[model samples]
Target: MEPIVDTVVIVAICVLGAALARRLGFIAPLVLLVAGLGLSFVPGLPEVHVEPELVLIGILPPLLYVAALQTNLVAFRRALRPILLLAVGLVMFTAFIVGFVVHALLPDVPLAACIAFGAVVAPPDAVSATAIARRIGLPRRVVVILEGESLLNDATALVMVRIAAGALGAAVSFWDIAGQVALKAGVGVLLGLAAAVAAAWLHKRITDPLLDDAVSLLTPFVVVIVAEELHSSSVVAVVVAGLYLGHRIPYLLSATSRLQMDAVWKLITFLLEGVVFLLVGLQLRDLVSHLEADVATTFRVTALVFLTLVAARFLWMYPATYLARLFPRIREREERPPPAVPAVIAWAGMRGVVTLAAALTLPRSANVPGDLFVFVAFAVIVLTLLIHGTTLPMLARGLGVREDTSAEDALAEASVQHAASRAARERLEAAADGAPESVVDRLRALTDSRSNNAWERLGSQAQETPSAAYGRLRREMITAERHVFKIARNEGRISEEVLNRAQRELDLEESQLNRSDD
Candidate 1:
């Protein structure tokens, strides 16, 4: 039951659960959540409490950073109006609506307290949406909205939570609080940009890839703390920094650093994402153990809020996507909003840790029943994540939603690599006078191989594309070579070093082939 020991145990369960989730073909987060719930019932098990601060500071940054990195900033800007409508406008609308419903249903609770609960829980969870969205490859615009909203809505929700908490006994309208909140949010954004610039400057000077990756990990936390200390939006700070860093990362990172970062961030994302959902399920016990309201009333209120949650999103998305297109300027600049895109975005409105964490921040003096408040937040999170998260892929497939083809992406990647490889070949040609003919031939062979691979991807038909045919042959040859290498190693015909060197070459070729296919 020691703190570290308990922490280790939970992480082990999450790691094991993540492995099982992948192998069993379930969404990893959903599985981790189920596993966490199952573990809660083990006899004499130590209590697991997820702190709001830890979720916000320790967890939110890197996840948000990674999501920002994955997002295309220019594309995000093109969708700016709709993204704002959902991220900011819808967040506000949901809070007011949920607050009124809660107040009307539970009049004994102060209006501000009910409203505060609404504010805390209004924003769809960025983490939850990101985990699922990335896996399924929601349409590009949908990804932008889901991800952009996730990054931005936290600041909106938290600002409202603070204002609502401060106005508990007052008759201040939520709209009236918006002005002050906007001012504070602006400060947070400016500060976040400053932090990002500072971090970028520092990153540029560090030559070591390991140290650079470490800096990349730390940048989010440092910015979050800076923003929070100034009473600004830490989420905004992290998001802004992440977007900037991710956008400019190519220019700043060495090739080796870029490769290292890709692998490191993937592992970090997989595990952190696993733990976040695992923590979601782990909190179920605490939320339900002290049910302080009438069971039926609690269920009714929870059901009402859940319905409002889904309805608010649909209502907002339709108008935001289609109705706003009535403006000539807007229509001229943006794609005619697709109908199916909104369906995916609406279904993606699952609230997450920020909501729960905000729920825990409720002030006791506000006279709200803490158990009822937490329970409602907990129930909504579970239902939405379980329902929305699990059904998203099915919904996408049912709706015939598909991401850009891997072939399309492969072509783009190949084109960029081709350009770089050509530049390298030009440089080598410059050094041809000093270099021996054997070195020249070997280098040219490697360049030609890469160039052919790129050119094959461009013109190939379906799976029978040239790269595909080339990869199949190459893989078969590599397989044969691998077997021979193993046999030689086994029969003592080759030394370990020689066999390993040869095998490494085959492995690299196979991996390159797999990358082209993917």
Candidate 2:
């Protein structure tokens, strides 16, 4: 296919798949994966050459950057214990368990190759986990743990995979491998922090919102490229930079810059996510061709490997949660520890692009059966995507560990308080004018309607008063404001550009308020 035609086809598939996923109540990435699978069967479809470096460089930096930007660094810091246990400890545990099992089951395969397979499949895909977690209403803490794990574990896994591959290819020592992992991780962290601080400083100095927005758009790529050039982990660099800059973003950029950055990144995230999943599905043919064994043998080996992965997660999570509770810091810090957390974690082990990219990047000349390792990785990805991803919501529901109603209520109350505050401020501003009595009265009524006195009273007395009826009215007022702006622009009372800018600001404010509530 011509380059333009290929681009059009990819865009069409992504848009259609995203829409279909929403309509069918499934995640968009899953739809994209299925779409890619179908497209792979078409005779004239252009081949998607899988590149490992591109996965980390082209895809991961932006996605991780956005995720880091969205992540509440304060919350992450507070939940460090759980996040570390999951991100660092759990990943290592999973990798070792899978590696050991693979080596034991297939004695012919070299130990290093088995470990490589484990490393590739160890970390869960952040994009997939975030999409599903949001849909299923997973607790904020649970989502944080998942997100933190997804961000950092790849660094550890990649380091291990490279070390293992080296040992198999060249007779490297355990001491050398250990030293390299520590050195890489340490340097990567420093590189990431430095990049973040520099970018944030640069952003603060720039006064023009448009210029600042452009800088923010390019910041992640800068961090990733600089870190990788220095032989450090670009994934870690982008994530750290994202977290640091995101934490200081309010102070670093103007309101306009922040608004533009949020809007642009949201669209960018959607596009990258769609492209990653589509490419993942399309790479299956290449993976199949790389396997040395027949389809039946490959299926059997892959099935066993998948079972090992699922079992290991369950085994690890149960003990890990219990152990976490044993610590006073953890127990004191955590909210209600859902009894079904282990099961939820187990079911959430759906693998995606990261694993596929790692597998396909395996060195063709590496000794100890690189092809088998790729096949096993593919098997895990397919199993997790098809079975675990499909059943995760059901699992959460079954465990009674779905959305927490009380927490959501608290979030809603907080939102109502913020809206009430904003309304009061607007009312006070309008009341400053020498308006007529009727207008003043209407303003007062609106202010009273938006008040959160009932919520405050409930907080003090443990009363079960329902949320005030003002939320709907507040939404209506906002909608009316937007409609008025649109009409004014159409009537030439205001320029289209001005109206658009105002509308975007209002929409962003509304979105922020809603997210705060959630």
Candidate 3:
């Protein structure tokens, strides 16, 4: 199939699946996966062979970067111990366990090959983690740990895959592998910090919103490319850069730029995730065709490998949770979670596109078969997404791990806004001048109206306020302007550029008015 046509088809499927998922009350990625799988078997449809580079470099960075952007810095810091245990220690542990099980399943597969495959499948996929968290009511801490682990674990897995491959090919020593891991990790961190700090400095100097947005879009790609060129972990670079930038956003960005940047990145992240999950599903047909083992043998080995990976995560999480609490300071200072949190975390493991991408990179060696390795990795991702992804929400519910609620969100938001409103009023008073008393009063009214919205939402349902009526009228005016501009474009009275500029002004005005309600 032509590349453009194929890309269009995949995107359409993803959007459709995502829409269907929401209507059916399932996670979007799972639906997209199933859609891709079903579409793969269509008659005369060509199989998709996504270049591993496209996903790893092109898609992965921005996804991680945006995810890190939404991360709460304080929560992530508090959960650092468990996050590292899952992200780094558990990744390595799971890889070894997976390697052992795969080797046991297929005795002919070399230990190196087994480990290589394990590394590919080690990390629990971030997409499933985020998507399921939104659909289900995962606690804030659980969400933080899952997201934080995701942002770092891929780098760990990738570096380990590289080391395992080298050990098999060139007889590399254990200490050498350890040194390589440390050096790459350290360099990656330095590179990410430098990149993030430099970007923020430049951002401070740039006055144009368009230029600022362009830099923001390019941030993740540049961070990843530079780190990769320097023989560091691009994934780590993206994550670190994201965290730094997100942490500084309140201080660094103008209100307009923050709003624009938020919308742009959200759109970008959504599209990338959809494309990835859809592509994941589309590879099923190809994987089945290329397996070297008989159908029964392949089924047995893949199931065993997939099951072992899931079991390995559960086995590792509970002990690690307790291990962290063993420190007196940690136990004394922090809120101790119920044991059910670890169980839900364990059950939340669902491998996705990253594993598939890594599997595609496996080279056929003297002893190892690349096709078989790819097949196993592919099976593990699909099987887990099918089994674990489908069941995780229910499992978390059954275990009483639910804490996400509108009430909690509203309470937190109300508290932040309440404090911010006080600060805003003080700043306004400090800057007061010969400006009209009415202007100052209007500003104060807007601040109070905005801050009290969440509380009002949680309280009694009331009649429409005067402010809401004003906002509704303003939106109608903006809608009229949009329609007029669009008509002029259709009638050839205005150029496309002119129409877009007009529409954008109207859109921004509408947004400002709408935001006043909240």
Model 2 clash pairs are none
lDDT for model 2? 0.77
In Å, residue 372's CA in model 2 sits off its true spot by 3.2
Best by TM-score: 3
* Candidates by TM-score, descending order: 3, 1, 2
Give per-residue CA lDDT, model 1, range 372-406, as digits (tens). Answer: 88889988888898999889989988887768666
Worst 10 residues of 1 by lDDT: 458-467
Error of 1 at 351 (Å): 1.8
lDDT score, candidate 2, position 76:
83
The 10 consecutive residues of candidate 3 with the worst lDDT sum are: 169-178
Q: Can you rank all candidates by lDDT, best first?
A: 3, 1, 2
Please provide TM-scores, in order, for all candidate models, with all chains considered together.
Answer: 0.90, 0.83, 0.90
Report lDDT (CA) for all predictions. Answer: 0.83, 0.77, 0.84
Superposing all C-alpha atoms, what RMSD in Å does each candidate have to the true structure? Answer: 3.2, 5.1, 3.1
Clashing pairs in 1: none
> How many clashing pairs per prediction, in order?
0, 0, 0
What does candidate 3's lDDT look like per residue over 1-518, in tens digits?
Answer: 58789778777877888789889978888888888889889999998877899999899988999898888888899888889889888888888888888778777767777787788899989778867876687887888899988888999889888888756745534456557767888888888899999999988888787778899889999998888889898888888888999999888888878887888888888889999988888898887777776888777878788778878998998889887788899899777788988888898888989999998887676578788778888878888888988888888888888984777677888888899999999999999798799999999998888786656656644787555767888888888888888899999999999998888888788777767555
